[model samples]
Target: MLKENLVNILRTLQRERVFLLGSFVTLLIILGGLGFSFTEASEGGSFLKRFGEGLWWAVVTVTTVGYGDVVPKTSEGRLVGVALMVGGLLSFSLVTATVASIFIERKFRRERGLETLKETHHILVLGWHHDGETLLDQLLRRLPHTARVVLINQLPPEKMEGIRAKYPGREPLFVWGDYSREEVLLRANVRQAYKAVILAGRNEGETAAEVDQRTLITTLTLKSLSPKIRILAELLRMENKPYLERAGADQVLIRGQYDSSIMAGALASPGLYKVVDALLNAEGFTVWAVDVPSEFQGSPVKTFSDYLKNQHQALLIAIFSEGRALSLEDLLGDEPSSIDEFIRSKFVETGMTHLFGRAKMKFQINPADHQVLGPHDKAVVIAAQPPNL
Candidate 1:
């Protein structure tokens, strides 16, 4: 491992020739200063004072600072100063160009999606649009300041710049590419991400199938990379639901389903949509997950709700259970209609599929108020204050 690391260091130095050259020049200047300082000390000068003066002279000459507070009276020291001043000019030019080139290279990498991110447990957003910006705003408001968010989208660096400008004080890294490609996904560090929110990708005049197809492709790639990551995907067609789950999506939301329901309700009763919107506002209501208490096992659901509200000021809303999330019925159909089912079922038993999807939860909303709570059940609650993470 040490030998491999040495080889990598050598390769890095070779690539960063300007850095190597600058270091060499600095060493040479320091050695020259030390020699001159020692020579002066031999002539009854204080060693530390002479050495500090020599170093100061070397820096001032190199940077063209030349404050002229101290000067070497010896002929040999003057020649040394001239050589250092010349070398300093060269080094200064090299350093300035190197810094500029580094910025240009970073710009190109951001434009072409070539940089690999090294963050852990950050939220990875797969698709860019107005929805991406809205999600970012909501995430910042909900999460702490230290939380990081990354985007993998087809937006140019210019649009990404606009995003940064519009959302000042927060910097989000973005990779520009088709997120389904393994290289692009790795560039975004999908395996290390905590959760991925995949918005359906579409262009102007594109069909629903085409948009959901892109989302499916991205989901499959994400699942292939990390099964443990929580994946929330959007689907336009309800028929495409099983496909997304089989691709290892943890939470699948149908497009227009929530909005259409709210709109229909509004039609029946004017201003009903406003009430629902107010209730679901990102800042107004918070949905949190709470641990199941051992004492509440087999107790009535209403009893648990009362305990939570009285103790923690939270309202019991739903039960989130990891069990029953996946089954032969979901992967296959009511009947095993084809040989494909045999192969696919066995394929899912592989390590990768088990890693990503086997831990998915089945959220049951408003379990009968009088129903008994199970041992492994979690209460999904709406509360003014957040539950412990």
Candidate 2:
């Protein structure tokens, strides 16, 4: 409490520094001179008369409104009055400047404080309902390191703990305000933000269109202020999607009545949801891209098995030919004419044949397939490291 009081006192003193300093100095000079000069010079009088005269002089001198009502008779009193008059002019000016500086500073500080509170870059989610939490959770999970996610909702801090816990290190800056207010947009720093996602509260009895209309006003205001910020809004009805898109939303993620179709399918086939989940989760039979190498240009499929065997360390699938086949003789090269004759002649060396189909076929030539091979222009080979099954 003492620390807080001291801080408050310091701030107050700073705000009124000029006025306080001038007022105090003016009082000290007036009182000091009055007491010393009046004691020797003034004729014996009531204490009240002396008190009133001293106060009158202090006020007039400090305000630079000197009216010659009472003149100092003693040389000492006159000297003090001359000093007070000079001091009074400087103090009056100081007081005026202090008041003006405090007023201007307060206005600018309030604006800057609001701006700092609303700094957001990635998203501005407008409601704190269950769906809002779910949406935030999904986004946070997908982009774990995202820095700025802003929430504009009136829910108190206690109710937002779930979001805090789920995100762990990522918590959005929250603002308490009505979504329809223009000031709320300014508070959220919507102008400099990247995108906005507005959600409707489930408890609100109003139609989705009605709720969306209020959100749309905020979106339009934000867009007008910052034309580059993309808006992604949510709607309860599918019919409202077009309206939201027309209202300048880059994308409107809306709830549709199409869930019934999925439910009907699920009821007919119990395993449908499982299959859908597998595909969506990327848990099975994933697709991967392997870059082609520069060394395998014009090399025969049977000549590059070392890639899959030694380098890739995976199964060698079939290789496909790329581009139109050049001269048949160049493709056929020097393959044995007949298997029986070549074997009889003790020449059973296997060689690549250029022709029967667009691409050549080889059986488990893993070592040759593993060689650095260029990408095919026509077809790609499918290789996979099968999980233990």
Candidate 3:
């Protein structure tokens, strides 16, 4: 293991040209020291006559320090000193230029969005549209100050800078490219991401269906690369929701689905829209879905509600369950019949295995106080921030 590590280190130094420069400098120092000692050997009482003193003089001369404490009086010794001085100037200048060029190249790549990111567990946002700025603002507001976010799109560097300036401290990394491409996704380190949001982007002269098609393709690609990444996708048409769901999206939302209802409510009752907008976009507080603790498994909904209100100052608005509530035995039934086996085989052959155990995420907006909490239940609450529980 040690030998392998040493070889790796040597390879890196060679790639950086540090090894070559170091070897050259070492050779010059050794030759200069030996020559000085040999030439000054006849000068009795001269410090340079000693090999150790000669080495010290060589070090000082090569570094351009010129301490002048041990001077070489002989002609041959002075000639060695002149050679060391010229070599020192050339070597140090090359080293400085090499270091500066490396830094400049890295900066250039980053600005062009050509640098690959290595962040893990980061939020990935794919595609950009008219409402992208608003979406980014809400995400930044809800996320913790230390959380990382990466944006994959074809936005210009200047536009990215403008977006960063708007959000003061929370700057999302930008990777410029066609987001549907696998190479671009890999550059953003999508496999290690925690969650992804796919937006319905608007391209020049493209219809709603065309936009939805792009979203579907992106969802399919993301799931194929990282099956575990949770995806929330947007659709321009409500009819395209199923396509996104089958493409392995965890959540599918239609654009403007609630706008009509909110607008109607505003017409019926004044100031209704303001209240709803505040809840959705307010920085002080927002609605959050929190997992129910294990200790709350068979407790009544009213009890959990009271505990949140009293202990954490949070309001529990509803109790909901995500995905199918099924056990391992239930999922893989008592025994697969001949017909079941045949159907499973067909699904695998058709590349529709994703639909075998698929279940829609269900939410119960409000439940009776007597409702008992299930093991996989989650509490929908309104609080200043998500509760630790």
Measured over all alpha carbons after superposition, the RMSD of each candidate to the real structure, in angstroms, is: 5.3, 21.8, 5.6
Worst lDDT 10-window in candidate 1 = 349-358
Taking the tens digit of each residue's C-alpha lDDT, what string does model 2 give over 1-389?
A: 57865765468657678647765776765674465346435644666676567667656665667787755666776666777777776766667777677668754543233323535465777775666765776566444375678777776655654455566567766666775577877777777687777776654577766776766566556555565667767777776564454345665776645578667867888698666545334454322223344465556544444454455444444443345532234422164454223222221122222221222322222235334344552223333332111
Scored by lDDT, the top model is 3
Model 2: which ten-residue window has the lowest total lDDT? 347-356
Clashes of 1: 1
Superior candidate under TM-score, 2 versus 3: 3
lDDT of 1 by residue, 1-389 (tens): 57865765466546868668778678867976785695456455688878888887777777889899866677877788788878888878887787677668866876566777777789888886657777787777667667788888877778787786675676777788888788988988888898899888677898999988888777767766776788889888999887777666777998777877887899998777766676566556667777788898889999988888888788888987776446434555555554435436544654443433456456789888888888888988887666553
| Model 3: residue 209 alpha-carbon error in angstroms | 2.7
lDDT for predicted candidate 2 compared with the true structure:
0.56
Error of 1 at 10 (Å): 10
Each model's lDDT comes to 0.75, 0.56, 0.79
